[model samples]
Target: MADPKGFMTTPREEWPRRPVEERVRDWDEVYVPGALLPIISKQADRCMDCGVPFCHDACPLGNLIPEWNDLVSREDWRAASDRLHATNNFPEFTGRLCPAPCEAGCVLAINQPAVTIKNVECAIADRAWAEGFASPRPPERLSGRTVAVIGSGPTGLAAAQQLTRAGHTVAVYERDDRLGGLMRYGIPEFKMEKRHLERRLGQMRAEGTKFRTSVAVGRDLRAAELRARYDAVVIATGATAWRELSVPGRELDGIHQAMEYLPLSNRVCEGDLAESPMSAAGKHVVIVGGGDTGADCLGTALRERAASVTQLDIYAQPGAERDEDIEPWPTYPKIYRLSAAHEEARDLETAPSADADARLFAASTLRFTGDGSGHVRSLHLVEVDQARLPVPGTGRTLPADLVLLALGFSGPDREDGLIDQLGVATEPRGTISRDAGFATNVPGVFAAGDAARGQSLIVWAIAEGRAVAAAVDHYLTGSSRLPCPISPHDRPMTV
Candidate 1:
């Protein structure tokens, strides 16, 4: 238990964000540095530490929330960090990037605002780094078996770290010059600085987990050779084949996928380029899709000084409160959330004719009108009904110099040839097929994360990575001591 009456006495407060005017001018994170520590101890006290904490079920990683909350409330950073890292490999990434379904499942959320579980977790993680609580935990003895993990995203990194700590020789293969997949590129610096990622990579290196960059396993190194070299192979390559828009004039200049646009900005941050070639500076940017990816684009465009930015969502806007009948407690609900980017858009008034946010809910793109020089000039759209069918006479147009499709991804990219070369079974939805144990049909082959689960949250990816590591360890040896968080079929605690 965190505090006897803290839940009732203390109101919920979150990590404060920097002023919009200043943050949008730079690539630094949106949060006010050193602000969370001052308020986090009180927030942790608000945790009731219920008899059956649903936060564990809500989190795919099955983190010991109550234990860490108690530790944090007592200002015990070492114990809190140990408990936090017991299940999760990278709390820093999750604390920054994850949407925090754990808070929704909190017992306090039944009536009052939930304990700031996400903020508390982030504070604990940050304090751990500052207090030197995070250190390399290398294995005591070496195991003869070896493992090859493809992809360096959260999933791959988690699996590699677990197996390496279990005394197995592990090597992670990444195609890009950097280690992190989407985290290094698709995610913007405003949400989470890359230094957090770099720090964890350094720890993993010290723990003896090898990383191979700029090496596409299917092309640069044949899957056959890799399979023969390693005792087992784990395909943790995330779903990266992005969805497309087939609207009229989609091929016009200035039309690009979100991936193509986001990576350029990241490259500029990495010092690989002085400026992003696909920058949104002084342009009217229209982003299709209202998910987190679109919000990311919105923030990046704002930072790059876009003249105007608008986001389109096919689904209608949700209410502020949860519909208890449709979504009961402990289950994640669809609610209107004003993200940092949307707040910036509203406060700065960078959107054209937008209400509070730059989003146009229930609006569907119809076509693109181009100038005589073959560059996009404007976007045509129509309001849609619940069925997503266009409503009569609800057409409109908006200036659009750059059109970005952030419609999300379908499955793992096949162009890498990993799927074909390995001959792994795939589901109808294009995800790699795996058994309950996260094992593929092919012997000694395993699949996890987005590659097997389809595109999903960062928490789910890390959970799958830990579970797959346990399965791989058992296959290599007769038994294992690794903790398996979830099965392949296990899902979130939702109605």
Candidate 2:
């Protein structure tokens, strides 16, 4: 146990963020650098280390939350990092990007605020890198087997690293010019800096994981050719076929998908462009979805000096407290929580609309009216009930020079012909079909992450990656030593 009465003695204190005025002008992460190190130990102490920690069940990666929490509270960072890495392949990525469902299932969260698990995890990962506790662990002997992993996102990276460390010659192929996939382009620097990604990639390279960027597998090399070359192929290409909002005037200029807009901003941060061609500067932006992606668009638009921003959610606003009848404890409930982007929107008054948080809940887009030049001028919408049925006489229009659809993704993109050429079966939901062992219909071919599981949290992606690696290793050899943290049927704790 971290402390017998630590939960009673300490209240949850999160890592502080930089002032809005300062962080908005720059692309650096929102949190104050080096801030968590001082307070993280105390925060970790708040963990009860319960006899039956539900946090383990909530996390897709099955992270050893209690062990790491205890290690962090004792200031045993190396041990903490080891325990964290025992289950998770990339705590840094999940520590920053994951929504921390584990905290929602924390036993303490039944009444008190959950122990700062995410912050403690992030602190441990950052400190591990700083103290040289993280290093390459190359295989002692080559297995003489080769594996080709498609996609360079979190899933592919995790799978490749595990396979490489298991003595297989692993190669990861990415369609983008650079590695990290969405982490390189989709995610803004304000959320997580790329330096952390680069550091991990460096470690993977030293561990004998090969990377092939700017190579679309199905196009550059046929699936058959790849199958013949490598002993096994793991498809970790994430769900990228973004969902569309089909309505009147859908083709108007200045209306784009959130993925389309977010990546350009990331390119600007990467020095690939002086400015984003789809910059939201001086425009009234209307985001059509009120999820993390919408918030991401909101933050990027604000940094670009958008005249105003408003995010619309189809679902009604949730209450501040959990509705136990609807979503029970130990399950991830849909509650009203303020994200950094929403906080910025609220503080800056950038989004002037029905909701104070720069969000219009129960709102649905009707159509976009275009200016004479074919550019979007305004957006029409209607407030609705929980069933998404429009409320009568609730129609309204808002100035919308730019419209972004953050409605989420449907499935993996088929543009590269990976699925078509590979003869892999797909589910009705557009996700790749995988067996209990993460194997696709085709032999020697496996699938994982968003490609198989559909769009999900980064934690799930890494977990699927690790599990698929073990399956592939078992198929190649009669037995395997790799840890399979999760099964293909496992899902996050959600209502």
How many backbone collisions does model 1 have? Answer: 0
**What TM-score, over all chains together, does every model reach?**
0.99, 0.99
lDDT of 1 by residue, 1-495 (tens): 758899989999999999999999999999998999999888899999899999989998899999999999999999999999999999999999999999999999999898888888889889989999998999999999999999999999999999999999999999999989999988998898999999999999999999999999889999989999999999999999999999899989999999999999999888999989989999999999999999999999999999999999999999999899999998998999999999999998888666449999999999998999999999999999999999999999999999999999999999978899989999999999999888999999999999999889999999999999999999999789999999999887767
For model 2, residues 150-243, the per-residue Cα lDDT tens digits are 9999999999999999999999999999999888888899999999999999999999999999899889888889889999999999999999
The per-candidate count of clashes, in order, stands at: 0, 0
Listing every candidate in turn, what is its Cα RMSD in Å to the true structure after a full C-alpha superposition? 0.8, 0.8
Model 2 collision count: 0
lDDT of each: 0.93, 0.92
Please identify model 1 stretches exceeding 4 Å from their true place: none
Angstrom error at residue 251, model 1? 1.0
State model 1's lDDT. 0.93
